[model samples]
Target: MSEEDVVQYLQNTPGFFERNPALLEELTIPHPVHGGAISLLERQVSLLRKSTAEYRGEFERLVSIARENEAIMKKSRRLILKCLSGDSLDDFAGVVEEVMREDFAVNYMSMVLFTEQPLDTSVRMASWESAEPIIKEMLAQSGCYCGVLSVAESEFLFQSQSDSVMSSAIMPLVSFEGGQVVYHGVLALGSNRLNHFDKEKGSLFLDYLSDLLSALLLRLLP
Candidate 1:
């Protein structure tokens, strides 16, 4: 193939010698010297085409992955908007669970809200007895709130003692008006899989969640 033909072919290929001008120079070498009679132009063209095809495949695969990630992110953002507009706490909780399940692929979920200072010694928030210790510890530690994602070992230990949760993320809700504290509560989340609530995974979503819960708590106070 002629040098001009080779250059045009390379340019037409999706990912050919776009990076190197030197390759074009070698192909355009006007006079052939030495023993090799035929110009190695056709050989270079074949290699370039093969490399271009592989790169095009890789680029396409990356594009597919990016598109999938974008769709998931959009769905997650929509779920957050839905949570913000929910009419009631029950509605909010439902949306929260749905978002976790559908967007984060979380398998288990729960929430706990703190009560007034006199404390609602009357009842427990979760039906699971195993959670009582964690709740008690949180209360005693002056921890406004906490969320935990149990490691595989912790999950086994928890289950051995009682029904255990795999992963969790907790946040505290403190309600105040005119500098007077009205209520404090913890919001909890759980997932049945490992590393589901890692810091890097859902930090933005969790921050939004904390803000939503804090606003709701503030509204609940007199």
Candidate 2:
């Protein structure tokens, strides 16, 4: 009989193995690693061992990821607490900048609010009247954007530090009250290393930070 016919016969008649149990001992195949022949039972054991090893490696990787996410969450909680402790926009900005420099490990970071708010104008912000078209475009996309920044975009966000920065992540900050945009702002991050930010980077943490910033900024409103 052909190999396919033998396989089909074996599958069609499961009782054959029980009836002819002695045939199992007779069955032998060339070993994959060793030069000698091995029984079918040994081959099956080898396959099981390989599968178990693969599963173990996957479990270890998952554990590592869990630990990393936990660490990141701890840092995020600290940042949120710091943001909430500030009484004014200037205080809030200081906390954000200091935490980002000390904790987030960013080369440079800044905030820009596009609306007239009751804060010191010297606190690194531009009102809606002063916002350029590029800023509007950034808000139009309306999410965390990570990658290399163009010359115009970098200049607009970083200004004096534009030439020093090689990569950037831009997150639009908007607080909504009943679907209406109340506070429009931008959080700009810069890095001297070209590969610091990539397009494929996950947005979960960035989104969380933006939400926290937006919530804290809501206190500025009337």
Candidate number with greatest lDDT = 2
What is the C-alpha lDDT profile of model 2 across 13-102, one tens digit per residue?
989989998888889999998778998888889999999999999999999999989988888888889878777877777888888898
Provide the clashing-pair count of each candidate structure: 7, 0
Give, for candidate 1, the lowest lDDT window spanning 10 residues: 119-128
Note the residue pairs that clash in candidate 2: none
RMSD of 2: 2.8
lDDT of each: 0.56, 0.80
The TM-score of candidate 2 is 0.84
Model 1 score (lDDT) = 0.56
Q: C-alpha displacement of 36 in model 1, angstroms?
A: 17
Write down the TM-score of every candidate: 0.45, 0.84
For residues 109-160, could you state the per-residue lDDT of candidate 1 as single tens digits?
5555444333223222432244445444443433233345335323422334
lDDT agreement of model 2 with the native: 0.80
Error of 2 at 165 (Å): 2.1
